[model samples]
Target: MSQSAAVSPSIDLPENKSGPHTSRLGLITVVATFGGLLFGYDTGVINGALEPMKLDLGLNPAKEGFVVSILIFGAALGALIGGNLADRYGRKHNIMLLALVFMVGTLGCCLAPNWQMLGLFRFILGLAVGGASTTVPIYLAEVSPFEKRGSLVTRNEVMIVSGQFAAFIINAILFSVWGEHEVIWRYMLAVAVLPAIALFVGMMSMPESPRWLASKGRKQEAFEVLSQIRSPERAAAEMEEINALSTNGDSRPTSSWKDLTTPWIRRLIIIGIGVGVFQQLTGINSIMYYGTQLLQQAGFTSQGAIVANTLFGLASVVGICIGLMVMNKLDRRVMLLGGFVLTTLFHLLVGLSAYFLPESAAKPYVVLSLVIAFVFFMQGTIGPLAWLLLSEIFPLHVRSYAMGVCVFMLWITNATVAFVFPPIVSQFGIAPTFFLFAALGVLALIFIGTMVPETRGKTLEEFEDEFKAEYS
Candidate 1:
């Protein structure tokens, strides 16, 4: 993406005071983000479960990495097609299907007869995860008023982190109670099934995205859905805006994969892909998925590390909560650059502490603090903001499709990092691994500084116009 650098001008939208329907909007957000909860639990469970699983399945280092990273490969595929599925079916329907996949996949993994079966089941679970990563944010963004869009859509990220925290807590409790029980990992994996059921039942009552309805020319249906979420006047106003942006005009272009090849649209999609790739390469998910392993390498015992890993998850939850509260007040570019800088420093500190602390009793706790700081800065800034921008940056016609492509790249990058991480640490040690991440973080900071556009408070329509100017 060329950084031609258009100066951003914010558009002031009409004030939309909260109404009686605000509670209804909150309900929908909570229900939709159950996808995120399942996304979090399924992915985070392996961090704590990997050891017991290894003992039970006789997994070597290479096989263990495959088992852990295969789900991400499946997620990459899921994200690749998830957009077309959401548009072809409705977003709510696709999400409900994902919920069923979550239940079946969790049960399959919990009851797997061998490592092979377990890997298969985990990939199945990843399908749901990848789909949710794309669909929930778009659904939330479309239903939300522009003023509340960032917080509302980011609520999914919050749920994702909260789900991971819940996994850490459950894993710790199970490990403490069961001690060396071989099947303890099964319980951790199976707990995700409960939220899958919740997501399925909850989405049954949720409405489809009104913006999607308008895109399909079902204007009245879209209006009805909007009225349920927005005040009467604001609902009508939003309906007008959606209609104006819809495909009613003879000059309006069709949304398709082919449109992605257009010069202007291609640049926007490139930017979206950059956003996704940078978010993953920052190495945040490494901690989310492998915190216990990292801590043990730092000097803690396995059990102690599993218990202490909960702190990482807890800090993530807190950071996401803070991000949600202050998200509306910040510029996306500024916050992202600041986050990358902090994460780079934290990574360097973690590497240096491990290299120099030298077999001391205090080394583990000291390293843990640095990791915790990294998690806080990450989840608080780039983690939530990345998903927020991906959901908001694309035009209404191509929103879901573009987001699918972006997240597909995100999962692929995530999988690459996860797959290579164990081998890298094994060959280079924890200090050198972290030093590599720190260097990558520096490059990611440069990418954000030069390439990403500021999307704070901009309407989807306003962004649409900006993209159109490239073609005009």
Candidate 2:
């Protein structure tokens, strides 16, 4: 930003805005975040449907894993393409397109006649999933006030886990009511359509990402968008700040992958990738994807396992709410460190309990409670914060590129965990599986202590200036 730009008034959101504006902001968040809901529901819905899908389709371990992971592979491709698309067309518009793909994917999954067909459709769905996971946070962060950005963007993460929980409950109910039915997996797959439509129509009425508009040099449109989310005092101030940042022809590059080979961009990409990969290695999603199996091993029946897994999702929502409360108050580094410590302890306890306990009925319940505690620690500490950092760590011109590259790693790591977790349990059993996760948890604690920076109370403009000074 220029000296004149730095002199512009800092934006301060209303401490006394009317409830209607708040509701509008909330509505925008909900619509944009539906992208995340579908992301969670589609991926998580499979956990329950897996057994039934496998039984119906006659799949073995390998094919079953394929059926589960094919979407992730498609998501990787989707992230790359979607990032470019969002950067080009506009965030809200791209999200609308993604919602359509999500709807079609759900329909395809519901109507798939065979495993091969299902894998193909899941891949299609993944494209939308991957797209939403990358675009939604960027959209939310760009639209939100710096003070509220972390919480706003993380709302998507909260919705994601909540959606997964909802899918689990809905699946469990459908399974019970329609027990002994062969096509029940079809119902499980179909549940995602309602939210997909909600996302599509909701996005249709929403504004484009404010930052994206600024990046595109549509200053007037960007200001109008800021108006909807901010008090008039703040909206005008943010418009000036955005204009200042865009002075050097927007500082938003439209470039090929080869352009990202610059040293600084490369380093930032690595940081983003670290942010993505580390979040997953913490093994939070293992609970989302395979918690039922883990609970069953600890000795719960099928019904009991589904009921127990819902607690993790509920804990995740609560944890994210707390996380949002403290997000701006705490540094990203503090949250990461504290989260690592808390999650590590939970993992250790989970492993120790299972290692010492016999196959008693109480063991499953104990493990379920531990899973709940683990999620509470995980979501409150690492889950919401990781994506927030990832969204902000890159330079302005390369933000989308850096995010897409990084989130690609995120989804891949997720796929690895989801794909290998079941086999790991079968081969080494639950004791070693949790132990391995616990050990990785320790490594994560060490990683956070040695690296990661504090980024709070800093605007994107301030962040760029600070990083430029540090690196120069």
Candidate 3:
């Protein structure tokens, strides 16, 4: 079936405005971004909850890894189909479904009777995480003006880091007050439910993606939604571009799989896949997922490790804040290149510190400092940019589908790393693991330098034309 035919035509957008107002646009962005908040909170809660969960659930190392990594496993599947779901359903509608999934999964995990049940629930939560990862950026990208797209899409990234930061603070407070209590982990897991509810309520009134609206022949609805977010003049101009692109895409088969046979489409998808792979290969999620564990390995006590891990979360939030401020000014390609290079160096230094300070009392603090720096580099450059690029890189017709495929690979790679990370650390120690990541980072750098295109300051239609001319 044609991709366009797969979507429903009667989808409704948010309440329309008579004129453009920045406050209204901000409200749309804020509401849409609740998805990112939940994504970050669910994932980050695990960083501090794992040890307590392990003890309460009688989990051994292997089961601990499974429980922690299982969410990512589900995320891989969610991401694999998330783009198609967004295309088939409206972006806003799909996110609402994801919010429901988030609440159910969080409740299940919090009340899980055993380790197996916990794993099952975590996998369910992964679906929402993966779906939000695919859907939210595309939604934001479509609603935003071309000039402001980079910064606006990145607001979701900032919210993600902010959510992680919130999780860390909550983890620290709960652990401080109730150290080792069986219920502390449950509290951490349950906190995510609040945000899930927030997402569902907020998205209920949110507008559909104007691009998605245009794609399915709801041009007036698209224009009205666009008019709310953009100046009337700018809205009219962008609506014209969207109509032209929609008309052009109408000639091609809507099935993204069939479109892949075209050289440019294939090349674009391949590049998108590369970007997703490299983003995960940087080993950032491994650190985010298990920062406390790694700090303990570096010689910190359990309490100290959790507190120090908060630093990692803070660094990410700060880094992303800086990224938001400068994203419009920098070239996307350059930001990614610099991120890879800097992260590789940080990885090497971390490995070396582990080797040289294996017996030092200050080992944990030194390693912690270095890891926070690594996160800063990652969040400032690759973390936000990866999602931004994925949202913007694909042509209008297959943008969501292509993003889903790319983020699917991303989640799979993340799951693989998370699953094997414990064994790798147990067998070889933290030092060697950092070295391994450093090696992968070198490859990521090469891929970015050679394969990634600069997408800054261009309309989606402009990119579509460029890709068609170059590869089609």
Candidate 4:
């Protein structure tokens, strides 16, 4: 890609008129983001539920890690295949199937008779999570008008953090009410089933992605879907561009895996993978999945730790809201670069505090404050930006496959961190563990500064043309 491409100015498109069409688009976004909500709740409920689950399930540290990380391993597989499934079956159809999987997995986990059964169900749940992660953003991106794309696409990020926040609150409440009960974790896990059912029912009325329809030579069907969401004039105009791009030899959609061997496609894949991998390297999930334990290690009681961890979830929710408000006004690359710098600085501060601060009552508070700051910056910037970029950067022909491969690497990295964090933190201390993350953050910063391109203002077709012109 050209250096100038990294600094392209925003495009000015005609404003979308507000009407029933606008309301319909908003409704669709709400329905689709339930996938994100489930993703957040299922992953985060583990933070508080794990302690009681360990007691009830006779879990060792290794078993605890396996139970938590197995879902991520399943997610990796889901992401790997999800893209192709969406490409083959259609985005809306793929999502509906995933919702059923979510219900099954959640119920299975709720009724699991043993630790092994819980792990099996968790992995099953992960497949739904992974599929949703890859499919929902693409669905959002394709359906949204370019001007509102940033905020709309990032709404999934908002729902994701909100779900995490809900999990934390529910976990705290259930733990307080049933702290004596061995069955409390079952209730926490079962909450996910409600959203899964909502997503399935809600999507039944939702339209398929117009772009996916155009790709499959269903242009009339695509236009009807677009008309329901956009003004007739705007929908017609957008369809012309979609059709033109579809017919153009230079931008033809390629389904074969061999097309990935093309240079420009390979380059985008690399950048996409880098974005996904570095997002995980931020150690955000480690904090999300183990915040209670980390707080306990800092000297709080188990109850206090669980309560304190809710603050982390709250910070993520607030941060993503801030991210949504500013998303359209800022450059994607700048937000990512700044997020990395701030998160890395906080990682260093966290390590320093854990190492230099005395073992006093104030130490945990100080560390907690620093971690909150880190999550704030992370969720506000990198968290949403990573998914937004992945959704935008690929050419239409290869978007699903490329995103799948990228998100697959992402979940793999997440699973590695989730599985190893306990053992690493147990063997080493929090300070050393954070220091290692700080080191990884430096490398991630370098990658973002050098490789990430600007996708701030261009429509999907325009960006694809620019990339093809620059790199073909």
What lDDT score goes with residue 151 in model 4? 99
Off by over 4 Å in 2: 1-21, 248-250
Question: Which ranges in model 1 have alpha carbons more than 4 Å from their true place?
Answer: 1-13, 247-255
TM-score of each: 0.95, 0.93, 0.94, 0.97
Candidate 1: tens digits of C-alpha lDDT, residues 364-429: 899999999999999999999999989987877677787888899999999988877767877888
lDDT values for all models: 0.85, 0.80, 0.84, 0.90
| Best candidate (score: TM-score) | 4
- Model 2 per-residue lDDT tens digits across residues 1-472: 1222122124342342554557778889888998988988998898788878888999998898888889998998888888888777878888999999999999999999999999999999999999988888888877776767778888998888888888888778887787578789999989899998998888888888777777777778888887888777777777777777677353664645875786656666767777788889878888888888888877888888877777777888888888878877777787888888888788888888888987776887787788799899888879988888877766556676668888899989998998888778888877788788878878777776655655676677656655555654
Candidate 4 lDDT at 377 equals 96
Clashes of 1: 0
**Which is the better candidate, 2 or 3, if ranked by TM-score?**
3
Name the lDDT value of residue 48 in candidate 2. Answer: 82
Instruction: Please give the range of 10 consecutive residues that has the lowest summed lDDT in model 3.
Output: 1-10
For residues 1-472, could you state the per-residue lDDT of candidate 3 as single tens digits? 1111112111222223346456777888898889999889888999988878878889987788788888998888888677888887789999899999999999999999999889899999999899999999999998886667899999999999999999999999998999659768999889888878988998888889888888777899989998777777767777776776666653231546776567887888888889888888888888888888888888899888899889988999999999999898888888889999999999999999998875877777888889899999999999999999999878767778888888998999898887778779879998899999999999998888877777776677776676577665
**Considering summed lDDT, which 10 consecutive residues are worst modelled in model 1?**
1-10
Query: What ranges in model 4 sit over 4 Å off?
Result: 1-13, 250-254
Of 1 and 2, the candidate ahead on lDDT is 1
